[model samples]
Target: MPVFPKISLRPEVENYLKEGFVNNEVVSASGKAAAERKFEALLNHLSHPPSFTTVRVNTHLASVQHVKELLLDELQQVWQFNGLSVPVLQHPDLQDVLLIPVIGPRKNIKRQQCEAVVGAQCGSAVLRGAHVYTPGIVSASSFMKAGDVISVYSDIKGKCKKGAREFDGTKIFLGNGISTLSRKEIFSGLPRLRGIGIRMTEPIYLSPSFDNVLPSYLFLQNLPSAVVTHVLNPQPGEKILDLCAAPGGKTTHIAALMHDQGEVIALDKIANKVEKIKQNALLLGLNSIKAFCFDGTKALKLDEIEDTEGTPPFSPESFDRILLDAPCSGMGQRPNMACTWTLKEVTSYQPLQRKLFPVAVQLLKPGGTLVYSTCTVTLEENEEQVAWALSTFPCLQLQPQEPQIGGEGMMGAGLSGEQLRQLQRFDPSTTPLRDTDLETLRDARAEDMIRLANKDCIGFFIAKFLKWKSTSEKDPQK
Candidate 1:
């Protein structure tokens, strides 16, 4: 059963998406009847959380089996229920991956005397596998003391004023927990923040919190995100470029896969996000990554000396592999209850993505790999862009992806069926939302859970292109 309603968007935005679904060729392939149903399913699934939580174990340090055993032990200690038993399973495709099905909207969880209100972002994290962070706490009952059991609620509409004594606006029950700090201790100074304010004992959705637990040995990333790094396949001792890499999730993974042997240059347009990339790289102990605040659209350094190294304004055809994970209107993200983007704002990313694609192609060496990806499900940002690239760049040709887990590319962008097959698309709506009432669905086996988890992932697209060697250009001297 669908636990949440269809994701709420502005009327204009909804109409825009609806038009795309109806008019798009791939969606309409089965005729208008099937297209409408698929569109509806997409909307419904967007509001609900995924069935399972995925953790990518850092195989560089600890083995997946070792981490799985440790994680199971931790869950046993944390859950400790007489009748309930939570299982941690390994992913079939990914070696260093663990999956845990989230048990949620549980029946008959009693409300506590005290109450604590948190933001929507924190609420979504709790549904997954996270503990409440200090900053997420928005309001608490006036007399709520330390050690008091309280019911946690999320302010979904962002209407709950911070530090308010009471919030009557729209809120949803998350779970129950015990307060770790007293009201005085939490709101004493001007900042009034320190440590964990609440320790969730009986969360509605039960998933293990891996915070600071095997940080080096395990990376907490979404399943689709893990697939992205694997698809890029950065090789050792090769120079690679991560255009628009902030927070450095994929960038760090690429370096790790290369055994920290090659130089991975990570660039982001924002200065603050660039700092975050550096911080994440340091945490992961990946020193090969060189993060900089630079516009990827202007990445090529024309007229620069060829001898110059380890600096900005890099010469054209410098990197062996390039990842253009372009900035996009993130419409495909799940559990997004509300989106405030105007139609203009939503459509604005196509031009920027187009501008970045040329530079990505230029930065790659002849016969090098270039992967273009986005988190949105829009035709303009995905298939249309691919069509444009093929038309504009004669040297580029689509390459087949290994471990093709996602569905083929959508049809509407005038690409032939053969051309569409080369692209990878993870569409969450295609998966069946398990019926809650069915005993088989409730008690699904581990293998079944893993399959569901993989299918029920965020909407994303990846297209890999191999830059063919041009006869006119001479080989570089070693």
Candidate 2:
């Protein structure tokens, strides 16, 4: 039953997560044994890739059907050598989604004496169907040649040296690949990676690489991530603000939903990330987005200058809708294999989220919507934050979401059933990994496969709220 090792966490961090899952509410609902089992399942699930690879069709450029056909053609051409024929299916609930089953933790491949090691992040990408980029190669065999077959390993513990001759630390095997760059070329080729360093000939997992495959027609996004924009439900010609937008997946999605007619202001703390957002918007041909390199918490305008002109520090209640896809510990990402974070680092996001919450509320117009989301499974960042939001801001009320595919909020947060139902928690712990065979998957019913894809995705949480206060309502914080 065990495919990959359980996700590695510090003892304290593991205990913290354990306590939250085995809390009173969860125990009362699912019993002690079941809750513990779920927790164990979660740890194991995180180390392995999800059953399906989800992509959101860029509906602005082409129809979902059109993109699906193009993707199928490309995948068939790429996999023709290995006779890999995976059927690409549309999500029943989400018309814009296309799901392709990821096929392995394939255990039959023999290891090669020539070895190459990649960083944890790059290793995760390989599991999700990416070739090893040159910059991500941490260490390679000293005598490794470019065409040599190499056993690829992920330095999951982060102990591998940058240019070491060999590493004896804890590493997980990620199958075999052909080295495209020698160790000399890898070390010398600095500043930027010239090309893909390792071309995977036999990956532990089998999924299609989207490197140059219809980049404009489709976006490689997790299923729940695409769902966040849909729950925000950005209408055409409405003023929307993405509080912590970077690399602009959701921001671009919102603009596309608005038919590229309305203003979609995106903010990120980093300048490079802001540029990435702009690039995504440009690539998608969506011009309604304006990305700013500024803190989302300090975005509110306390000054009397009513005309701030399309910049940061805008007047109160300026946006018609807001999306706070807040930064978190990111524990919910799959194929993580390990987390080298201390307990302090793991628990540091709640305060930042709270600071951003009030600012989002202040910037939203009366009767506007605010959708808060995180790519994490923690109670503090998910349910606990929702409870805090409701108590601190009376204007914010939990609102129901369409396509409620994820499970209800975890217990022990003091939220009622109805309140929890309004929150969507895509907990990987609750959803066991399914068989990832494409042939057998094709035989399954569409509804069954769609449900499987929804649950077997990156762990995510989303909470939508409606601001019920009037325009004249006084600021709660002030």
Q: Tell me each candidate's TM-score.
A: 0.91, 0.96
As a TM-score, model 1 comes out at 0.91
RMSD of each: 3.5, 1.9
- Per-residue accuracy of model 1 over 1-478 as CA lDDT, tens digit each: 6766677778998888877777757455788878888888998887777777788876555678998888776666664232456667888887667877766646568997688898888887777756676678888889999889989888877888888777888787878988888776766643645667888878776666777766666677778777887888888999999998987878888888888898999999899999999987887788899998988887778766565466666788888999988899988876676677899999999999989998888878998999998988888899889999999988899988876778999878898888899999888988877633235445777777777887887888999999996423755883
Q: What is the C-alpha lDDT of each candidate?
A: 0.80, 0.89
Model 2, residue 130: what's the lDDT?
Answer: 91
lDDT of 2 at 325: 99
Query: Model 1, 233: alpha-carbon shift in Å?
Result: 1.7
lDDT of 2 by residue, 115-135 (tens): 999999999999999989888
Best by TM-score: 2
Q: Which runs in model 2 stand beyond 4 Å of their true positions?
A: 79-82, 191-193, 471-478
